[model samples]
Target: MGFFQLLMKKKELIPLVMFMTVAASGASSFAVYSLWKSDVIIDRKGNPEPWENVDPTVPQKLITINQQWKPIEELQQVRRATR
Candidate 1:
């Protein structure tokens, strides 16, 4: 028998098959929408920020290093002292 004939013979499973097909399609659509949404980045207020609104200045660091460069031993000592 053909696929359609098989389905027709198993009439009890028709609703379950239809429901699963619809659910899968819905889930796939939602997944596609989520992927498409990730491409868009929004601001704090859920709106897109204009280029003019963005600050170009450098931000201050929370932790500042007095010495520009130091040996690994000195750095390890400094880290241990902080702890």
Candidate 2:
């Protein structure tokens, strides 16, 4: 009954809605993959397999301590003499 009611008034829009839905769903997680083409629906390439294991390289914070201080951190403590 409910399904029939949905189809009753705007019958023409049904195809459009279905097409849009399909396109949306297809585009949700669709990947064109490496060396491929993409459109409304991506033309998938089955040639090369995807990277199974990703070797992530993390960069370490590199610091250099010079012997001389550049004025900023080298400021001497100020002394206030009491009268």
Candidate 3:
């Protein structure tokens, strides 16, 4: 028999099939809306910040050296001794 004839014979499954169709359509519609909104937001934000326009005269710290490994108590003692 055809698919529609089978469905007609089993009347209880019609509501379940209809509910699934509605749920699937709603989920897909929501997904499309979300994608559209994301695109609109990205377009509105415009181009990203340019990195090439940085001031060359500004002093920049290129390297940091932490050579000392003194304990907190020793540091305090050293500060008192210096004073």
- Best model per lDDT: 1
Q: Write the residue-wise lDDT of candidate 3 on 1-83 in tens digits.
A: 98789899999989999999999999999777665432234443453433233343443333435444434788669868988
Candidate 3 ranges beyond 4 A from true positions: 39-83
List per-prediction Cα lDDT, in the order shown.
0.63, 0.46, 0.62
Q: Please, what are the lDDT tens digits per residue for candidate 1 over residues 1-83? A: 98778889999888888999999999999776655342345554765544324333432233555635434788669868988
RMSD of each: 15.6, 20.7, 18.5
| Consecutive 10-residue window with the lowest summed lDDT within model 3 | 47-56
Full candidate order by TM-score, most accurate first: 3, 1, 2
Residue pairs in collision within model 2? none
Question: Each model's number of backbone clashes?
Answer: 0, 0, 0
In candidate 2, how many clashes are counted? 0
What is the per-residue lDDT of model 2 for residues 15-38, given as tens digits with 9 covering 90 to 100? 988898899877764543322322
Candidate No. with top TM-score: 3
> Which ten contiguous residues of candidate 2 have the minimum total lDDT?
52-61
Model 3 lDDT, residue 15, Cα: 92
